[model samples]
Target: MWLKLNKTFFGTGTHIYLCAVYIPPLNSTHTADDLLNLEAEIANYSKYGDIALIGDFNARTGEQADYIENENNSIQFLQDMLPQDYDLDSPIKRNNLDILNQQGNNLLNMCLSSRLRILNGRYLGDSLGYHTYFSKNGCSTVDYAILSKDLLPSVEYFCTSDLNFLSDHVQISFKLKCDIKQYINKKDFNNNNMKKFTTYRWTDVSHGKMYEALNSDEVKNKILNFEITHFVRNEKGINEASKSLTEILDNVASKTCIIKVPIKQKKSKIKKNPWSDNELKDLKSKINNLGKKTKT
Candidate 1:
């Protein structure tokens, strides 16, 4: 289906035509060839100064094609579709090496024309939470951008991250210092027509009642509540620290009891017994007394 967006912006006369069109979603009965035809039509329309064809083409580029032994069909589709003068580059190419090293899945979301120079480009993996938006389990790149080739030299930095503070798709942006010399050499500047006109003064737009009402009891209470909460947290932290210091000092000042050691005793050797004369005399007297008693 072909649709014409009839709004002409910036005074139309085929000098520099800038357009943004919504291409049909992929795999909707229409084949890749159909998408190519759509791209060719845009290329035809962009024959003027510069053309930037952007949006999700749904065609995978870069590392996505690295594994396929025969990428001719896909590459040929893009070459035939896009204008020959245009340049193509995926900012995701910077992460392509790392992706390949990790054997990652590539979605190839970017392309540029030869007319455009790539100052910088990258896949916003984790810096933007792009993966979470897509419902992908982990961080990955599925967004990208391409700049005109003429604009490459002045590029300062090209980069991305997986921070999910914005849209789920990774945002690709770049900075370029416009070559003022080119415009100067082209004699595009007219100094005589750039003079400033007369001046004007400013006036206050606030209402007298509104200014007075801003200092209401409700506002004062809200401000006081915030201050009280902050002060309470600070005071609580100080109290906790003071109590911890006292406990630590008390533990350090406590007296400790020391243990004493016992000494070892040596054992004596055994002595042999010898017969005595007093023991022999006592035995003879006991035998004689016993014999006399028996005779009586």
Candidate 2:
């Protein structure tokens, strides 16, 4: 195709074989065969380590079945005997593409063969799979980010940025899980810092309420009246605009979104029995006899 780069990152827990590619465009000298070959080359490294393939594949894989889904009416015994296919719970991917082409089929085949899963429609940010490439010819999703099953769980967020960043194709951004279990609101990252604030999961906000509030005239007017151009003018302006927007969102979110604070369970204390006397045992027997007499 055009160009490809392979980089290996060694982590404490795992090693990632990242293969970035810029495959040749659709009707040119390069074609879908190159995509299959790329998958083969990438799959070859699975023997060594985990894989993460991200790049402009020039392959518009619209709303395609990237993985071979398990048979709905498969027999339990047969399924157990042959568990080659991945998880049975196949999630539906909502895409923005109008149609799936040959390149899409080839791309899906590559994903299936490579044992990789696309992160676009699967993540919170790109839940509605946005088109990555746009031009006069039309819009399509040619860029992609795929990861091994193990690495898939670690992806905290994934989204495709708009072309406002000075590019014909939208940029893809993703985050990996990190330990931020507890912390004081910007005080210090130290064990002694016990003054921790109750953190609310903003990511798990009520989208229904959010959209409703944002679409309201009150919120919409606030957004419209505020100078949007000032957002990119200067650092001070950016912060000011961001704070204003955050305030507006937080105000509505406070009313709608439920706060998810982790419950801290207090450890239970156990005490030894105090009845070590024979007399107490006899008294208990007498009480039992009295209770039987009362019943009779």
Q: What shift in Å separates residue 206 of candidate 2 from its native position after superposition?
A: 40
For model 2, residues 173-218, the per-residue Cα lDDT tens digits are: 8886634443224446554344244444545456666767867888
Cα-based lDDT at residue 1, candidate 1:
20
For each of the candidates, the C-alpha root-mean-square deviation to the true structure, in angstroms, is: 36.8, 16.4
- Which TM-score value belongs to model 1? 0.32
What RMSD does model 2 have?
A: 16.4
Error of 1 at 230 (Å): 54
Candidate 2 ranges with C-alpha deviation above 4 Å? 1-12, 75-89, 92-94, 178-296
**lDDT tens per residue, model 1, 1-296:** 22222223222222333333334344456555544454465466555444333334333333443223344556676786778784333332233322321112212212232233222223223222122114455444333334433334444655554455335545545444433343243333454333232222222422333334335564445445544543333667657655655443333222111212233345676543465466877898999999999999
Output the worst ten-in-a-row residue range by lDDT, candidate 2.
Answer: 1-10
